[model samples]
Target: MTSASVPAAFPRAVLFDLLTALLDSWTSWNHAAGSEQAGRAWRAAYLRLTYGCGQYIAYEQLVRDAAAEVGLPESAVRSLEADWLNLTPWRGALDALRALEPHCKLAVVTNCSTRLGTQAARLFPIRWDAIVTAEEAGVYKPNARPYRLALEKLGVQANEAAFVAGSSYDMFGTAAVGLRTYWHNHVGLPLVAGAPPPEFEAPTLDSLLPWLGRFGLRPQTI
Candidate 1:
């Protein structure tokens, strides 16, 4: 893509899952738990709680509860909050976002509180068209509200945009709202049983541009 070029308009917007898709949030959790095993357990518990709870629950409270469910101490929760800013982007996240920046609208529909979602989204340095948090939507995903809220803010229908999902659990939400999804399955987690499959899945974002190209994301003349 060059300055004389622009993206085709079919996919007018690209929505992302900020925490897991864009950032290496797993590392932060691992550090907070003092071990990868404990972190995985705690994070998995957190996912189940959020996705199954349906309605809104304080995001931080869910985190603390997840820690306890996994037999982790309150100190783990303290460490997670204290080291939140230490979260970094996944490899190639910056490049992928930068490539898409001038091409189409970019937004985030993350399952987090507004404060934490805003902070995590800022790590990108890209001007997001919108950032819809679970708190704002009054429900955690795999509920459809957060994704629908983001689509509304972007002013595009579900078919006119694509969702980048970090967790397979997102398959339920995106499908419910009729949004096509591309799973950035960087962690190699298995798909959720009975969940809809994404249009594409990869260990990294390297294929995102090419995949978008298939949907008329080519460059346009000035």
Candidate 2:
């Protein structure tokens, strides 16, 4: 959709996907694994396991399992898991979050377990309105349950919230539940087949700031 086609008012709340959207966890995995290919494989393996199980698994355990699947040593797996404790924010992620915080409610709805989600939040200080993990919802993204739960927690209708996702898979899930989606397409990946396209797209978290004006958002004085 064109920028002018965007709604004139911002959603009452903003839901964010935690892993890649807010934190640079993939880069940490790549550094620990010593190759980008291996890091991608590990993430793929982790998603396969998470979806295959149809339930929440702690991200650290998922990391260990992915390490095993990718034939990484125990030491490397440990390092990868430890990296979650101090995940680096994507460039301009914190600034973007800070800018948006006062304008609307902000929440994180992630595929991670509650422990990992909490740890990630501590690493980056934002007063989130809600933090919903798959573990709490008893299901993962693309399932509809977690997204619905997030909407419930935020006390907003689907149309009254916007979901910002780092992956097309997540965009599909968020859109399926009828929330406006903004895809953070840092890698220039094509949209996933069989899923609806996101309502908005940007190369980085900071790129979304200027576009918020289309939603009629203004900085609020706390």
Candidate 3:
């Protein structure tokens, strides 16, 4: 391809947070909790546990621990596990992804076990260029490994890529790894205190493609 046809307006690769940014794991968590109130609290606890632990830990254990911390029973954990496959894609997520696919390589950097992470990723119809899980990286997000692992797999430097973060906590890791992030704040969660802000923030993935248009020289399919 000639320089004039290169996809210069967009990064060469875009990495996404699987759980929050691409899929709606929240509904399944709430369903497992038997109420939205219980589900939200439990989910929050889980995030706290994952973000603080730094190194790898059994992801399911964290879920159970978080449930108990929020007064949920063991059954909630079971329910969540059983219903894990039911996690839905956020509205417009697929469309936005399809739009970017021709112009950029796509991948996911999620905080999940290899089993569940692979399963959750299969829910999407597209073939990912890379799928980096906490299990695979031996560390969770906000730690540099997972994000860097994805970048390594994509064969791109951090500056050559962008991250679509589902949670504000991702800002810390992505920044440390030198990847510009676009916070897909679909749930309206607050930014974590002391974390860097994302390059862009939106309630839905619809804005992702448009925001990406502002970068690089001119976009052509990669």
Candidate 4:
């Protein structure tokens, strides 16, 4: 089927999960881990402390593991994040938001402590209509509460919002809760083995413009 034939409804508010969507985080994680030798004693600390013992785990688990490997606590990790340069700006994210901002409402829905969430927004360098953090809701992604909290703040229904995330499980969790999900695969990462694909998937944010058009907002002709 042609791409235009797909179901691509623009959301009243684009609920963005902060870490990987707007800011590049993987490079920062690697850089931090590399600063020390194989994370020294921290590697064992990470592998042991994080709850999920299986092969495949959630994205947050990675953060915890990295913290442990660095001989830091999760609370400390939450307070310290890689510098902005470690994170590359998402390709076309700035452009898409500039285009979409005129027509649709936008907000951030991140899974982090309140302090970290606000810090992410400051670093993102965009003006959001609103920003909702997990700390406010006392929940995290892959759990329905965070997304629900974002929509609630927007004063919109779950179906009226489109939740975008970089992880498969997070995408699935958002979809299962009721909102349409757009998976931001910026790194060209492979889709997770068992998780169902999201309503949107693309190598870069530029692709989101076309789908945004279907929702009564199209990219500026320039």
CA lDDT of every candidate: 0.88, 0.78, 0.89, 0.64
Q: Which scores better on lDDT, 3 or 4? A: 3
State each candidate's clash count. 0, 0, 4, 1
Give a tens-digit lDDT track for model 4, residues 1-222.
115555545668887877777777655654555543434344335423421332224435656766766666565444335353345667777777777686667888776556666776776556788788756765556667777777777888876667777666676567667877778877676665666788778767766766655643353221
**lDDT of each residue in 1-222, candidate 2, tens digit only:** 115655445568888888878888888888788899988888778776775666666666877887899898778787776777768888888888888787778889988878877778777777888999988998888778888998998898887788888878886677679887888888677776777888778878765665554544443111
Model 1 misplacement above 4 A: 1-10, 217-222
| CA shift of 207, model 3, Å | 0.8
Better of 2 and 4 by lDDT: 2
- Which regions of candidate 3 fall more than 4 Å away from where they truly are? 1-8, 217-222
Q: What TM-score would candidate 3 get against the native?
A: 0.93
lDDT tens per residue, model 3, 108-159: 9999999999999999899899999999999988899998889889999998
Candidates, ranked, TM-score: 3, 1, 2, 4
How displaced is residue 14 in candidate 4, in Å? 0.8
TM-score per candidate: 0.93, 0.87, 0.93, 0.73
Give the Å shift of residue 156 in candidate 1: 0.6
Which of candidates 2 and 3 is the stronger one according to lDDT? 3
Misplaced by over 4 Å in model 4 are: 1-9, 35-66, 69-86, 216-222
Angstrom error at residue 133, model 1: 0.2
